[model samples]
Target: MRRMLLTFCLLSLLPVTYAVACLWDSETLEQERNKFPGTLEVITGNFPRHSPAFYQWRLDDRLNKLANDPDNDRWLDDVAVSYEKLGRHSEAIEVAESQLQRNPDRYETLANLATFLIHDGQWEAGLRYIDRALEVNPDAHFGRERYQRLLVQYLLQNFPDGQVEYPLAAGDRIDFPTFLVNDQPPGEDGQPPKLSIEQRQAAVQGVVGMMRFSQHDHPVLLEVLGQLLTETYRPKVDAKQLAARCYLLLADSAASPATQAAYEQLAKKSLNLQATHKSGSEGQMGLRAVRRELSGELAAAKKRYNSIVLKEKRWIASGVDVEAAYRQYVNSVQW
Candidate 1:
C-alpha cells in the first residue's frame, strides 16, 4: 500500500502531455506523417467522448448557428457528428451527404461521411468514400483514413457474403495474422516477415479510431491495443506491463464471465513473460517494482478518466483542438 501511494505520487507529478508523434496541429503533424507515407499517426487525444445529452446540446447549438449563417458548412460536420453520437446515423448521413454534394473534393467531409456510412452499416459505400478521401488528401488526419480502409477490408474478408454487423468484436473469432498478412511471402529465413512499422501504426490507428467513433472500451480494440504494445519497442512505459493492463481492462469491461477469465489469463501470461526479459538498462528497477509502477499509472489514469467524464455540468469544447482527459486516457496507457 505504501509503495502504491508513493508510485501514485510520482505519476501525479508526471506531465499530462500527449505522445510527441500526435501533436494536435494538423499541418505541423502532417510533417511527421510524411515520413511514413501510408501509415496512420493518430492523436487519439483529439476526439474526446461526451455524453448523449452533451452531443444533443451540441447538435442544437450547431443547428442554431447554421440557422443564423447558412453558408457555414463547418457546422454541418458538427451536426453530423452530433447525430452520429446520438445514434441517428441516417440523419448524420443526410447531413454529410448534403455537405459532400456542395464540396465533393473536401477531404474532411468525405472522411466524416465515410465513417458515418460505416457506422450505419453501409460498408461498401464507406469504403468507396474512404478511397475518394484518400485521393483528395492522402495524408489528412495523419493518414487515419487508411486505417479505416484497412478495417473495412479486414471485415469484408471475414464476412464476404455482404452480410455483416457493426461495432465488430472479434473476441477470438478470427485469426488476425492470417487476415492482416494477406498471404505475403515468408522472409528469407523461411519465417513470416516481422511486422513493419507501418503495419503497427495501422493497427494502433484502427484501435484509436474504433475507440473514438465506436465504443470506448470495445473488447476487440482493447485486445488489439494490447497485442500491438506487446511487440518489442521502446516506449515511455514497460510494453508488457502496459499490455497486461490492456488485457485486465478488457477483462473488467468484458460482458461475459468466461471472456473476463480468458483476458485475465492473458494478463497473467504477459506478466509471466516479463521475467524472461532481463532488465534492459542492466541495472534498472526489478520486475516487481515496474509492475507496481504500472498499477499506479493505470489507477491514476482511471481516476483522471472518471474526473473528466463524470461531471454533471453541460460542456462543449470551445474548439476542435481542446484537450480532455477522456482523450488522453488511450494515449496515456497505449503509447
Candidate 2:
C-alpha cells in the first residue's frame, strides 16, 4: 500500500516539475527576446510554437554574439532588414543607426536607414542620409537609383503646389513656375508681364541644373522635368524645340514598349509641328535622326547622323554638339 502511495505522489510531482521547467524556459526566452517594445506584442498576437518571432529570436541571439564585432556588421544589416520585414521600422532604424555609429562609411547601412526613414515619413532626413550614402559610394547603382526615387517622392509630397524655387547664380534666386497651360493668356491684371526669352531660358537652365546635380536618369524624374520644361517654356520659347527636347527625354527614359510608343507619338507630333512651322534647324535634323533610329530605320538614321556629324559642328540654340550627340545615338542603338 505504501509503495502504491509513493508512486502516486511521484506522478503528482511530475506535473509540478514540468510546470516549473516550462516557466524557466519561458523566462529565459523572454530574457533572450528583443527588448524592443512592439516585438513582444507582435510575438504574443501570433503565438505559434515556431513563429517569425521565434526565428527572429534565434537571429537576435546571433546578432547579440556579433554585436561588438565590426567584421560581422553584415549580420546587423540582416537583423535590421528582418525588423523592417516585420514592419518594425523604428527598431530597424535603431539598428541601422547603431551600426552606423561604429562604421559611418557603411553605405548599405546608410541606405537601409534612409529607406526606413522614408517609410516612416521622415523624408527630408531620409534624403539627407541618401545623399550621405551617395557621397560614401557614388558608384553604388542601387543607392543612386533609390536616391532618385526618394527625391521624386519628397518633391511630389512637398511641392504639390507646382512651384519650385532654385538659384540661377550665387545670390540670384528664381521662382520657376511649373503650371501646364495650352496657351499663355493675360494675367489677372489684364496685362500679362512679358518675360524675355533670356529670362525663360534662365529659368529652364536653373531647373535643369538642379536636376542634373541630383543625377536624374530616372523615368519618373525625367517625366516631371519634361512637364516642368514644357510648361515653363511653352509660349515663351519655340514650341517644336520644346516638344523635341521633351520627346527625347521621354523616349530615352521609356522602359516599356507601351511607354516607348507613347513618347514616339509625341515625337511624331513634334515632327509635324516642325513641318508646319518650317523650322528645319539643326535641332529638327537631330530629332529626325533620333526618330528614324527609334523606328528601326537604322540605315536612314545612320545616313542622317553621318551627315550631321560631318557638316554641323553644333546646334547652338539647344546647346547640343551635333557630333557628340550623334556618337551617343550610335552607342545607344548599337546594342
Top model number, TM-score: 1
Q: Could you report the Cα RMSD, in angstroms, for every candidate shown? A: 12.4, 34.3
Residue 322's lDDT in candidate 1:
23
Tens digits of per-residue lDDT for model 1, 54-163? 67767877898998886577888889888988889999999988887778898888988898998877899999999999999988777678767876777777767766
In candidate 1, the residue pairs with backbone N, CA or C atoms under 3 Å apart (3 or more residues apart, or in different chains) clash, namely none
lDDT of 1: 0.61
Candidate 1 TM-score over all chains jointly: 0.65
Sum up the clashes in candidate 2: 0
Please give the distance, in angstroms, between residue 100's alpha carbon in candidate 2 and its true position after superposition.
1.5
Model 1, position 216: C-alpha lDDT score: 56
**lDDT of each model, Cα atoms only?**
0.61, 0.49
TM-score of each: 0.65, 0.32
